[model samples]
Target: MEAIYIDKHYNLVVECKQGSRKACYELYRLYSKAMLNVAFRIVGNIGEAEDVLQEAFLDAFNKLKDFRQETTFGLWLKQIVVNRSINLLRKRRLELIELEGDHLENIPEEESEDEDDVQYQVAVVKEGIKELPDGYRVVLSLYLLEGYDHEEISQILNISENTSRTQFLRAKRKLMEILKRKGPAS
Candidate 1:
């Protein structure tokens, strides 16, 4: 069933690449909502996410000729949206810095702050994620939210795998600090 859906989009992608506006709109209709969610997760602003989505779609349309079939069309479109979101953040002078040695305490991945204990709302966690630094938020969103592994995040962010891991662990710690200050559900 999923394969058939992808095949249908594959046809749309071919027509879109051929400069068919109707096909382009059809593809956008199929993808825009989910792509907006992806952008919003990274930028943490609905307006910026909308702008990113527009810019990404335009960029994708322009670059359609260059897109080889190494990956699925949907994945290619997703990469465009993600890259555009990161670029917009970069344009705002948000640099994703890698911490030097000894800066971060080594916290094991399983040492989570016991999320179930608080009975906190999802909104609280989302707010905490927004409060994180640009670097941490990007890494955390890509990893925890987007389901990318550290290696994939490293490739996406152009950082070392170790750096991605360290940043993610630190991001978790910072999120925990924010949540703790917010206190448990009453």
Candidate 2:
């Protein structure tokens, strides 16, 4: 078997768009893990994440002609993965809310807390996030872990930006409640 050395992913994309199955498969092999990670973070289930990954790759491959090389191929593919994951969440009929008032100003700034304490708190929060309902989990992961703004999240999830903001806030409050219930470890 000849090794397909893909130096630039866009090159592979160009080849794949030209109907090279090998190049397309190689593209999938190169990006599947990272894409899967993004999907898993959004969907919060191994099986569903895998489904999203497969769907994302298929969509990316089919839509390769639309790729303009402005961003790295991996980033473009990751966006597809994220969109697929969000779509899956929406298909589950999650109730997303748009904030009506000026609640964005109320979001607290990160305080200068101790590094170790922050790490511990983040770990605890992550555990709590895993316990969240699928709807909250997806929005929370996208906003917090993936660093998406409400506008980006709204576009991704097909909800209003205010809804994204509101879900994120509620998710945070729920996570904090869970952490409080867990209490300090001995």
Model number with the top lDDT = 1
Residue 60 alpha-carbon offset, candidate 2, angstroms: 1.1
Cα lDDT, model 2, residue 69: 75
lDDT of 1 by residue, 1-186 (tens): 223334547888889888899999998999999999999989888999999999999998998998766678788889899999888888888766676563666545323355774345677888999999888899999998888898998888788888888888889889988988998666
- Give per-residue CA lDDT, model 2, range 41-70, as digits (tens): 888888999999999999998899987777
What's model 2's TM-score? 0.79
List candidate 1 segments past 4 Å from native: 1-6, 103-120
Looking at candidate 2, the ten consecutive residues that score lowest on lDDT are 104-113
- 119, model 1: CA deviation in Å? 9.4
Predicted model with the maximum TM-score: 1
TM-score of each: 0.81, 0.79
